[model samples]
Target: MKIGNLIRLVIFGLLLVFLIQPELFAGFFGLFTKNNQPAIYNQGSLLDITLNHLGIVAAATLASTIIAVGLAIVVTRPFGAEFLPLSRSLANIGQTFPPVAVLALAVPMLGFGTAPTLVALFLYGLLPIFENTLTGLTNLPPAVTDAAKGVGMSGWQRLIKVELPLALPVILAGVRLSVVISLATATIGSTVAARTLGEVIIAGLLSSNTAFVLQGGLIVGVLAVLIYDALSALERFLMKRTGQLGRA
Candidate 1:
């Protein structure tokens, strides 16, 4: 692994350690187990909580990525240019609005448990993806396209062989950003009973068992790092396959 990758791995481990401090201490100082009832969540297990958050975050991110990419493709096209600003702004607004506020507003209709969070997270994750897609596609060098055109390649051919290949790395970078953000945001799902890592945090807060919160938060943080690292590796693999990154 590169020095940078090693550094990131170390940092992630340190972060996990800090977040789970209460648990580590609970086993020693016994401060955590004192007066703690079996946590309301699955006999004090944080696994259930972490899984729920990850599920919603993953699902919402997938939906957002698909929609964002589609809208990005259309918005970058000439016919879509006139309204591009509006589309971009709407995506931004989605990110800017608080997830909790969105939950409150949406809960009346959505009624709870994953649906509101799914909608809000999808909206929240849109801008980075949509904007990045726009930037990546537009920033392609003119010479690449001119060469394709000069060689009598059709528009579709130019996009597939020239534009998309070159633009994919940047586009995937945006995807990485959205995925990480979605994972962190998934904690908000707990407030609506969406079965996520948030349950750990909330349960800890409610019961005053700091260890529970720490455990959940630590796991969630680790999960986020793992998720992001995997996506980054995938991005690198794609970049290499596309000739955007140098091959080993």
Candidate 2:
């Protein structure tokens, strides 16, 4: 009912309509084309391309979340505390180099297509999730953890029932950042022969078709905004539910 929600709804609706029936906007895109060049990207369906793009990002983010969160959990444990620096360094590796550089390196070993792109995205997404999770776990209120211990909760039980739940909102914040970054970065995967919205943008670039470029960029941009907004809402909800809203 709020203005911001209304705007998000309208944008999401338009994105759906565009993906479902892109031709309806041909005239609009045509304004950017020259010499009667085709306006829509006909090489692949916009809906299919968008779905593929989301799939790749989702897969990579999921993998990144599992590994990063696991590493954070391990490093926070007493026995694993000494490994914190090493874990941090490992997570930092993916982001230490530009994504393009990672892709270039991956291509030789993984071959072209989705494998290399997934690797690049997975590695690039790790640092944020790992850092956020680590921060969240380490910053827990000592009294709360002490209370859990006093209640006869085993270390594992305390972590499962007390720590992770409280830390989840912070972890989700990192996931949100990683997901948004992956959405934009995944577009570049097309250069490695992966099926993605980047195909439209690359084609437009090669042909000097501004329309194609605009269409592709618009879709990706809108998707990033929408997903970011959605994840932020979820983060706020979790923070409130976990009594961390005031801190936020």
Candidate 3:
């Protein structure tokens, strides 16, 4: 493997180790602590908090992908073309309102915990996926789509067999962007009592313990980078398979 690839693997391995056995690094973290404070966050298990964080992000990202991709597909269809503006506006709502504002609005209706957080993340993550999917579907080579129709494929068949396949790399790019954003944004969920790595950072901040903040930030940062790299690899693979690598 290339040196870059090898380094990423090594970093990923360390991340897994850190999550699973954070206590093992207590000595390292101790350097950042003062006044006899605990180095590792003892209020919660790093592994559990990390898992919950991942779960929330995964759920929100999945929902965003499904809804965004579906909306993009609808808008791209001739019958639904007129609604493109509406769809764009709807997706833009998430971007227009900040996640914290969404959380504030949702908390009264959804209550605290995961529900409000999910709503915030779901809305926050919509634009990238929706816009990318729309761009991908709208920018397809007319010749390729026309050939599919010329071969006697129905509209649905053409979309399913030809258009979607060609557009997947682009769609995946959007999903990747959303996922990375969600990973970082989800940290704020802890402000409303949601279980997330934000708890660690918040605790650190409240107690003036830099160790906790660094630990939480480091884990989230590493996770975002690793996930981004993995998705980029997938996008490149798909582009290569579709003979669009050169274009990329």
Best by lDDT: 2
Per-candidate local distance difference test: 0.75, 0.96, 0.94
Please write out the lDDT profile of model 2 over residues 94-163, one tens digit for every residue: 8898889999999999999999999999999999999999999999989999999998999999899999
List candidate 3 segments past 4 Å from native: none
Q: Which 10 successive residues of model 1 have the least lDDT summed?
A: 38-47
Q: Please count the clashing residue pairs in each candidate, in the order shown.
A: 3, 0, 0
lDDT of 3 by residue, 1-248 (tens): 99999999999999889888889999999999999999999998999999999999999999999999999999999899999999999888889999999999999998989999999899988899999998899888889998998899998999899999999999999999999999999999999999999999999999999999999999999999999999999999999999889976
Better of 1 and 3 by TM-score: 3
Using lDDT as the measure, what is the rank order of every candidate, best first?
A: 2, 3, 1
* Model 1 per-residue lDDT tens digits across residues 151-206: 99987788778887777778788888887888878888778878777777777788
Candidate 3: give the clashing pairs.
none
Note each model's CA RMSD in angstroms. 4.3, 0.7, 0.7
